[model samples]
Target: MPELPEVEIVKLNLEQALEPGDEVENIEFLSSKLRTQLCLPKDIRWPLSINKLERRSKYILLHFSGGFLLSHLGMTGSWRVEKKIKAQKHDHVIIRWKKGNFWIYNDPRRFGVFEFGVNTLTNKWLAKLGPEPLDKDFDTAAFLQSLKSSQRSIKVLLMDAKVIVGVGNIYACEALFRAKINPFVKARGLSSKKLELLLSSVKDILQTAIKKGGSTIDSFKNVSGEKGAYQKQHLVYGREGEKCVICSQVIRRKVQVGRSTFWCPRCQK
Candidate 1:
């Protein structure tokens, strides 16, 4: 899955590839949208010039000269930029620009979304997300305030989109491990100091993952078809029963909210 950092890279890559003055040569919609999805016309002519690329959480927003294109990679999807290549099976959406052809949205699982509208950047889909983990606004005080009334497990609380925007399953496990906090601890039971550690670890792990091109356990890559290099640096996620990298304890895994949670019993409380 493309987390916050991966989305950031995609935004940047799109921004650079589709330069500011580059106008849309043509737009095509591969699949039809159901009437119940509230989806507008999938195939339409869009007169748009690339303005700027912005990212919120895992969502990518392309601010055009007249409108916006919102895309969510969901899982098993990517926006690959290539000079030349044959379209693969999952290449659902494609955008042709002046500079080159950019393979926009490709998702084998088919959960990715591609929508176009005029100034719909602040739609309800993005407005509900919480503070981004790496942004300056995501302070320890703010984090604690968000969790002030929560009795859910710390892992579950962190995963809440209302609490923090983009800490996905992999980063959550790594962050909890780094903070030495048990994933099963109640959110309201954590002390201020522990919360501070958690906040810091969240930022640190996200930044590190972004720097490493984000995790690609299955099929994540940049718009350039390169696999992310972060998977090799994983410490605990998917390392169940292996010795913990920090305390030499066996890294344990359990299901919380239907997602696997990995932590070291000896290192994390």
Candidate 2:
């Protein structure tokens, strides 16, 4: 699935392809059955001009005059912009524009979400999302307090969407590795210095990821169909048994909450 940085890049790419005044020509569901269930309002009227695009957590929202279109790029879900769209076998949804352009959604696994409605703020999906980790509201003092309250391992705490949005398993592992903090250490047990390092690492990793267009672990592609380049710069996430970049210790892998976490045992210790 696309994490925060990936999702943010997707939003930016979509913004480049789509503009504020672009009129919606139509919305088509091509699949006979879903890779995932599609949620759309029954009375979706067409020709609604797009007002703006915003992202919350892992979701992409396109605000319109009457309502909004919320998209969740689940694992394998991607958007492609084309002047002349040659629809693929896995192309699930197509949002056509009046200007003869097409924004196509392709997801092989069909786990993505497309929810269209007017009640965006109160939507069930956006209700439980935590603070954006890069926001000033998620500053050091607040982050430290949250960490001190959670007994979960620091890695697990960082990965919790309710605690902080967009620190997915991959970035969580990378950030922890960068901070030289063991992933298995209890969150509340960390000293103030370590906690600050962890927070800074998280922001730095995410910002760098956004700049690199996010890590393409699997089949992730941007709106322009470009594979992410950040995976090439990965320090530890998938380098199990490899040498650490800093301490020369062996990189390791452990499963936490059903997701693989990679780190350097010696450096993080």
Candidate 3:
């Protein structure tokens, strides 16, 4: 699944492709399970231009003249700009412009979603999310306060969407490993110094991943249809049993909150 960086990139890509000045020629679903159940039927009506392309948490918000289109790029999902073409097998949703052609929202797993609602509900999906890790508001003090307020394990705490948005399992493991903190450590057990390192690591990892266009594990492609280069930069997420990049200690894997977490037992104390 695409995390914050990937989602933000998608928003930027979508905005560049479908700005307010552009006119929507059409909106259709090639194959959607929620054709009617999830989103309002493809109401390709006139006078509907994207007023803003925003992202809240991991959800992409497309504010339009009439309503909003919300998309969640679930696992194995991607949205990219392309010249309008015939619908492919898994092209769940297609949005066309008056001139440049179309954009495709393709998802093989069909786990991705497209929902429609009024602009007033933008907060609905973003409301419960915690501060963005890359935001200036997510400083050491704030992170410590948030973690001290919860007793969840550090790994689970990192995974909490209400604590911080977009730190998925992959990034969580990478961040924790980078910070040299044990994923199994209790949240409240972190010292101020360790907490500061953890917070800094989170920001650094996320920003670096974004700069690299996000990690492309599978079925992930940037708007240009190029796979992300960050996967090659990974240190621990999927390197179980491999030598740690820092200490040469063998990396280990464990289940935390039902998600795989990789770390170096020697380096990550």
**Candidate with the greatest lDDT versus the true structure:** 2
lDDT for model 1: 0.79
| Candidate 1 local lDDT, 6-120, one digit each (tens) | 8887877777787556777766656653111324445545556767788888878877665677788877878877667577877767777776755556778877778765645
Q: Is candidate 2 or candidate 3 better by TM-score?
A: 2
Displacement of the residue 266 alpha carbon in candidate 1, Å: 1.2
**Model 2 poorest ten-residue lDDT run:** 32-41
Which sequence of candidate numbers ranks them by lDDT, best first?
Answer: 2, 3, 1
Top-TM-score structure, candidate number = 2
Give lDDT: candidate 2, residue 50: 91
lDDT for residue 245 in candidate 3, whole number 0-100: 81
Q: How well does model 3 score by local distance difference test?
A: 0.79
Global Cα RMSD, each model = 2.5, 1.6, 2.3
Predicted candidate 2 versus true structure: per-residue lDDT over 1-269, tens digit per residue: 78999999999999988854679888888875454466556787778789899988999999897778889988989998989989688998989999888999998998888877687667888877778888866667877898899879998899888788999988999888888889999999889998888888889999999999999989888988898999998999889998988888888897888888898878888
Cα lDDT of all candidates, in order?
0.79, 0.86, 0.79
Q: Which pairs, if any, clash in model 2? A: none
